[model samples]
Target chain A: MLKVTNDQVAGHKAGDGKLGPLIDDLGRFYKPLQSNERGSNELTFYTSFSTNTRIPGPIRRFFPNFYGTQLVEASDGSSLQPHLVLQDFNFGRVNPSIIDIKIGSRTWDPQASEEYIQKGLKKDRETSSLPLGFRLSGFQIYQNRELGFWKPERTFQSLSADEVDLLLRKFVSSNTSANLDLQPDCSFASIVYGGSTGILSQLLELKAWFEDQTIYHFYACSVLMTYEKEFVSNGKIPCAEIKLIDFAHVYEGQGVIDHNFLGGLCSLIKFISEILITPEECTTEASPKDIQKNQIYFEELIK
Target chain B: MLKVTNDQVAGHKAGDGKLGPLIDDLGRFYKPLQSNERGSNELTFYTSFSTNTRIPGPIRRFFPNFYGTQLVEASDGSSLQPHLVLQDFNFGRVNPSIIDIKIGSRTWDPQASEEYIQKGLKKDRETSSLPLGFRLSGFQIYQNRELGFWKPERTFQSLSADEVDLLLRKFVSSNTSANLDLQPDCSFASIVYGGSTGILSQLLELKAWFEDQTIYHFYACSVLMTYEKEFVSNGKIPCAEIKLIDFAHVYEGQGVIDHNFLGGLCSLIKFISEILITPEECTTEASPKDIQKNQIYFEELIK
Candidate 1:
């Protein structure tokens, strides 16, 4: 069952409930594609919006349906409770190695924030800043970096302390260029690995979504990840078993630039770097020369 | 410009003009796709029913744009018109070597039956029969085998005598197993080459379309081809210059057999074989054993 959203989780209603707007936008965008003879069938309901066929064979089973809405009375006694209907989507063929995890703006637990992410922006304002007009409330973390088991109705589960430590150790050891030794403390590793990786997966999924389909996603939260489960050995977690999900707020167009999403992603990258090791050892440095070249290219294109 | 259907061309009006039925059917088929969120943007006005995008990249450039329609003065003196409008489509992009040929039930020319095709069932009953309730009037041909030029508004053109002869010679010579030699006469070559290749391309495209997109074309008659100009060596037409067009009547379903289209195609194939060589030398022979195996498989599945 999907986690229901209300004022308690975030200030806004679960944006997934905004499915109506999504449907309308898609209809409008696809309005011009009516044809009597020959063309693509990609725009139809099953192929376009639903994960039924669009999700590739390897990762499709995790997101089985766009299960419709549910109304639940908050534990805080906020609203009326009738029926909390859960939607199940038969996205595609099942892959046994799938452990779906959805994290984002909506998944942010207000009670647990002080320990997960510090308040305010980072020193480098741009990297830490959200994109203009984007709401942090809508941010989602999608990670498919680790393999997991195939279990439907799996909501976001926090990584165990040992799992986080094992993952961070794997990350540091894998990067030969970063000359950082594995930290001995599991407590610190959990904060860095569990928090940063969750956010990192969302960023990677966002970049990949654009590259694969040329579509940009605005509401990048509500992630679903899939992973293989058999790779677990000796308490060490493998780094390559995760996959992300959800593409409801994605759009297609020409020359449509995404500023906010990218800004948020970069911020996450920086945040992860800071938490994992000394700031000086971070490999995601944007060299002055690279920045200058991009500026020049942008100027030329504009001219 | 699109070839407008009217009383003069066939007993019924032009098929394209019957957009109402087409629209209705497509709407019904695609109505389930009316999702509020994720779906295809490919169904806008032109992309859904046209082969413009579905055609392989090798042949896409030849047919660009939904060229507007033309109004022709009815031979029956039905409409008072000073000018007949012809529709020209500017499909997206262009590649140089396209020689488009639309062939199928709709492409059957009224007066030119003798040189082209004679209406009769083939000796092989299976190839000429209709699939249960399917209508012959709805037959359409699809061809995108050859590469074509990207000039917009380029309609179908017949292959020249020299081009036809050259291509036939190539076909016969290329197949090492076929022990036939190229005939010296251009007229005989044209008859064999023109008639045989036209039907051959349709068959090739039908098989290819199913393999590529999983959509089967039932009325595979409207043919379009695109070929490179440089391939024409000294007036001798190259066998590689031909392609078929049209995919308007194709469908997406299971075991939806296309008997009439396949029958006509097989008949044309047989006709070509006869023209090219003695009936005994035809290489397209099907062993009874293969047919029996298919029959058994079908029976088992049905049972």
Candidate 2:
């Protein structure tokens, strides 16, 4: 029931600059499927599909901090579109603490500095020509709900001398291969909130550990769909509302929860590794390492 | 699921001796319903169905401990029944150091003693040869998969003096009337186990606290359900495999999650005052003149 949109929150902005393709140079990467002009205009195409489409594996993984992934049954079977849903998670819902971390702690936000912006722009040129966009409909700030939304980059909040050295040593590619199978003492179905007690979605999985007795088991599907849109405008806003119209097909579908879960969880691991851990201990600058030095930590606690 | 039967338990004698009626009486009190007995030669008839079908209003003054009262819900809807289940709450499940209280700590078990037996018989004779019946069932001692069927009543463990006094004090009398409620931190739900976990047919009215939210609001029912049954059978050596043949259309159907909640939470006031409180505390025992002298000096604490 929580509405997820830029309008419902504080601070808003739109892109006026052009973004060129950046991913083609990544070589051996994936290609996009061709699309045809929709029966309706682009704005309708974008809105109708984005909300309905199931989150993609890559995208879902990226937002590891999402509270509950409601697998709402999309009303349309033929429409290859994401399920239109209101999310409980909102990035703008942060502390705005303005506290500083030391250098080399998190991923560099493109909007953070001119150098990073240029680097990001160059990188985007390799990925795609169209501008990647996100907008907030609305958001409310709260207490315990604000955790896990902020993305840190190149900044260490407070690290001792040994901590910093140890972190760099860890990221030295010395521990590249390690077991990432350690399951967290977390429930599959969880309620993720913003900084405070903001109610997010409810997460439910097929065979999650919940009740005393283990009951029925069933197969499920994870699907994602995309839509094109026209210039977005909010009445008098600088741009026209980029309304999504079509929900044609899944970006990708028909996979197991484990695979999707792994991808999502792994992405979170990447985030933690990059933002929370030291660079020497991480493989990707975007996330924390997929492994841990101690597996017994969580197993014993759960037991 | 775990099960309990009078046959394997240590203390109870089955279908024989003078205690046969007593055991039968206990069983009837545990769970009572009429049998069709189509093939039997003898027919049983109600002696005072018209008069005793409804619990007298006066008993309501006692609350929680008066055993439950009934009012038939049929056209002759005078036979309405209430919910009040009991089970051996496995404290060891929380920790081995937790103490167990004797059945007679505050109020002596009327059924567990010889004097109660003699008095019950005399009262039954005076009251149409039938004691007022109750809809009770046992849920705690049953042996389930990992532990098998077991009993927890074997260890007739005595409560430490301090514990006894503390628990007694906890059943504080209300200002306006002689009623009771559990202390804030004392989530009494742990005590609602039967031979199996399902016997919580009594707590229908208090199901709201169990359905949702995550503070673990009242008590931890799942932990109570997961303890090792071995300790139970080792303790309640002479326990009985007791059950209710039919709930007789009772139960608000509060599912397994809500079962362990103490249904008659409000009724404890009477259970404490009438059954547990010393006769001297009531106006019945102390004379109007020297009642203060007759009362025992209240002790704050003892090392």
DockQ of each: 0.01, 0.01
Interface RMSD of 2: 27.3
Model 2 lDDT vs. the true structure? Answer: 0.22
Report the number of clashing residue pairs per model.
Answer: 109, 130
Measured by TM-score, the strongest candidate is: 1
lDDT of candidate 2 over B5-123, digit per residue (tens): 24222222223221211112232221222333310101111212113334334322111121332322222223433312222322113211111111100111111245643453343
Query: Tens-digit lDDT track for model 1 on A1-303?
Result: 223321111222334432111112111111112132111221332245454444455334222333333344332343433221222221222222222222221221112234332332211112111111112122121122352221112221232212222223333232211122223222222332344344345445554443233123333333322221122222434233233333333343222223223323332333334445542332212365533543443244224
Instruction: For candidate 1, write residues B62-148 as lDDT tens digits.
Output: 333333222333333444222211112212212222322223212222122343323421211122121110111221111123422
User: Candidate 2 lDDT, tens digit per residue, A1-303?
Assistant: 212122212211212221111111212111111234221222233343345344334233212121212232222222233222222222222231111111111112211345653463343223211010111111211112323112223223132222222222222211212222232211100111111211111111211211111111111111111100110111221110011111222122111111212122122222222323233232322233423323332233223
- Looking at model 2, give its docking quality level: incorrect
Model 1, C-alpha of A254: deviation from truth (Å): 17
Query: Candidate 1's error at B27, in angstroms?
Result: 52
Alpha-carbon error at B241 in model 2, in Å? 8.2
